[model samples]
Target: MKQIQTDFINKLGIGAFAYISISEFCGLFEYVFENILIIIKTEPKIIIWLPGIMSLILFTVIVIWGIKKFNKPIEIDTRKVLNSLIYLYFGILIAQYLFIYFGTDFLTEKYSAEFDFYNKANKGSLMLRGYLANIPILQFVVFGIILLKNRKTVANNV
Candidate 1:
C-alpha cells in the first residue's frame, strides 16, 4: 500500500517536472526574444547565447532530477509516468477552459455594456489565447517519446 502511494506521488512529481520543463523551454525563448535589445545593449554577443546555454543547463538539471526521483524503491516505469503526464496535460487544459468560461460570464454580467463590446471585437483573440496557452503540451509529446525510447537505459542506470 505504501509503495503504491509512493509510486503515485512519484508519478505526480514526474508530471509536474514535465510541465515545468515545457514552461522553461517556452519561457526561455520568449524571454530572450523579448529582451534581445536589452541583452545586446547591456552585455556582449556571448550574452545573447546565455539564454540558450542557461536553458540547456536547466533542461539537464530537470532531467537528472526527474530520473533520480522517479527511480525509487519500485523502479522507474516509463508507461506510468507517461500516463500521468498525459492526464495532467489534459487536466490543466480542462481547468483553464472552465476558468475562462466562468470568468468571461461573470465579467460579462458585471460590466455588460463595456465587456460586450470588447469581447465581441476580441472574441477570436480570446479563444486563440486560450488555445495558445496550452500549446506547450506539444513539446511534452516529444519529451514523452524520448522517455519511452530511453526507458531501458534509464531503468538500468537507476
Candidate 2:
C-alpha cells in the first residue's frame, strides 16, 4: 500500500512538473520566434529575453533528467506515465469547467474586478465554449479506453 501510494505521488509530481516545463518552454519559444520582428523593431535590452533563456535552460534540464530516469530497461513503462498525466490534466480541466459553469456568479461576487475582466476577455457563448471544452475530453476518453482495453495485448507483444 505504501509503495502504491509512493508511486502514485511520484507519477502525479512528474506529470505536473513536466507539464509546466513543457508549457513554459513552448510559450517562450513561441514568443521569441513569433515576435522577432517586433523585438528587433523595439530594440529592447538583451536582458528582456533573459527569463525566456532561463526557462529554456530549465526545460532542457528537466527533459534530460526525465530521459535519464525513464530510459532504463525496467518494468515501469513510459506509456503508463503518459496515461496518468493525460488523466490528471483532463480531470483538472473538467473540474475547472464545472466550476466555471456553476460557480461563476459566486466567483464574480468574490473577485469582482478580476472576474469581470476575465469574462470580458474570454467573451463567447457559453454553449460554444462548453462544446469546445468537451471535444478534447471526449477524444481523450475514447483514446484512453482503447489504450486500457489493449494494454495486455500491447504488453505481451512488447
Candidate 3:
C-alpha cells in the first residue's frame, strides 16, 4: 500500500508537470503568434489554428498518458489536483478575456503604424479568448463528477 501510494504520487507529479508544461507552451505560442504577425504577411487564421491544434493534440495525449499511468485501485486524495486544474483554467479564461477586451486598443494606440498587425493579433487573440472562456466551466463540471467517484473510493477505503 505504501508503495502504491508513492507510485501514485509520482505519476500525479509527472502528469501535472506535463499538463502545466503544455499550457506554458501554448501561452508562448500565443505570444509568438502575436509578434510574428507584426512582421510577416501570413494568414493569421492559419497561424493561430496551427498552434492551437497542435497544443490540443498534445494536451489530449498527455491526458491519456496520465490516465494510464495513474490508474490505481486504491483511493488517493484528488481534491488538490482537481481544484488546481479548475483554478488554472479559470485564470487562463480571465487573462484571455481581459487581453481581448483591453490589450487590442492598447496595442493599436501604442504601436501606431503597426495598427494593422495589432488588429490581426487581436483577431487571433479573440479566437483563443472565446475558446478558453468555455474550458473552465466545462472542466469544473467534469472534475466535479470525477470527484464524486473519488469520494466513493475514499469511503470504501475508510
Candidate 4:
C-alpha cells in the first residue's frame, strides 16, 4: 500500500497532478463525500441528485481524464509555469472585479423609478461578491508569501 501510494504521488507530477487539478480533485471529493454523509444522516432523499454535486463530480472526472488521457506537460520550467499561472489568476481576478464594478449601473445609480432592476441586480452582485470573497484565493496568496519568506529555510533543508 505504501509503495503504491508513493508511486502514485511520484508519478503525479506537475502535468496531470498540478496544484489546481489536485485541489479540484480533493475539493470535489470532500464535497461529495461530506454532502452525502450529511444527507444520509439528515434528509437522505432531499437533494440526493442535485445538479451541484453532479456537476462537481463531473468536473472531477473531467480533470482526471484530462490528466490521465492526455500526456501533455509544461513546455517551460515548473517554477515558471507556476508563476505564470499565479499571475494569470491574479490578472483574471482583477479583470473580473473591474467588469463587475463598472459593467452595470447597479452600484452607481440611485434607487429611483429608473432603477427598476436595482433590487435583483443588487442582490445578484452581493451574492457574487460574497461568493468570491469566501474563496481561498487569499489563503493561497498568503501561503505564497509565507513560502517566499521561508525560502532560505527550504534552501538550507535541501
Candidate 4 on 1-158: residue-level lDDT in tens? 98666544444443333555444544444444433444344333222323234444455455445434433442335455555556655555555455457643443353233233333334435445455443456435544554576566544542
* Candidate 3 positional error at 156, Å: 17
**Highest lDDT against the true fold, candidate:** 3
Candidate 2: Cα lDDT at 118 = 42
Can you list the residue pairs that collide in candidate 2?
Answer: none
C-alpha TM-scores of all predictions: 0.35, 0.31, 0.41, 0.31
- Tens-digit lDDT track for model 1 on 34-109? 2443323433333334444454445555665666675555655755776767676666556556655775466557
| Ten contiguous residues minimizing lDDT sum, candidate 3 | 135-144
What's the TM for model 1? 0.35
Stretches of candidate 4 above 4 Å error? 1-76, 106-158
Where does candidate 4 clash, by residue pair?
none
How does each model score on lDDT? 0.55, 0.50, 0.56, 0.45
Candidate 1 ranges beyond 4 A from true positions: 1-41, 75-84, 87-153, 156-158
- Model 2 over residues 19-134: C-alpha lDDT tens digits? 65454443444344423423233323222343344444554555545555654546665456666766765665565556557655565576566544444544544554455444
- Lowest summed lDDT across 10 adjacent residues in model 2 is found at 38-47
Candidate 3 wrongly placed segments (more than 4 Å): 1-45, 72-74, 111-158
- As for lDDT, the candidate ahead, 3 or 4, is 3
Error of 1 at 147 (Å): 9.0
Candidate 3 per-residue lDDT over residues 111-149, each given as its tens digit: 666657546556637756677555435443544455465
Q: What does the lDDT read for residue 26 in candidate 2?
A: 39
